[model samples]
Target: MAEEEKPFICFKNGWNMKIEPRNRKGWLYLSLWMLALLPIVFTFTWLMNRELSTAQSAAFITGFTLVMIGWGFAMSRWMKVRSEVIDMNLMIDFMREREAQKKRGRR
Candidate 1:
């Protein structure tokens, strides 16, 4: 069964502490995900400078860029999915409120 929820966004709701990511939303996660991958760039440069042969440097950097880019794309998709869930939750609340009002009017 779905759990009952108190009013959202108010400090009174116990969920306020846990649902914080939904409050700030996507920009933060996207930025953090990108920042998280940035260390890979430096690590790649270090490896190219130290371990890889001159001929391998270009290929290594290219592959690393491609992998990080792919990871960023996946993260973008993940953020979108999470945002959609938040939207759906809001939509369901609105619909349920409307239904409750209709029921009250009939009584």
Candidate 2:
């Protein structure tokens, strides 16, 4: 019964609040994000490697990294909002199914 249920993201049991995708939907989102980011990252790296001096490259990379981090955080939050809705609905469905199974098992 448990094997049939699948979720986009699974909650990790730990002190750190980390969430990861467990199914194809999650993988798709991650893959798309990586695809979107790859070109920009490559462009930055290429430009910095060839055009910037050592100190300049360091500064550019630092700034770029910080901006990318901020962008990533925002994207994650947006994605989380969508996934959480799906997760909540799935949880409700799972609970309902479990209850139905229990009632059947009793008969």
lDDT per model vs. reference: 0.61, 0.69
How many clashes in each structure? 0, 0
TM-score of 2: 0.57
lDDT of 2 by residue, 2-102 (tens): 64433345443333335566678777877787788887788787777686678988888888899799878976775665443334555677999999999
Off by over 4 Å in 2: 1-7, 10-15, 85-107
Using alpha carbons, what is the TM-score of model 1? 0.45
User: How far off is residue 3 in model 1, in Å?
Assistant: 11
RMSD list, candidates in order: 10.1, 8.1
Local error of candidate 1 at residue 100 (angstroms): 34
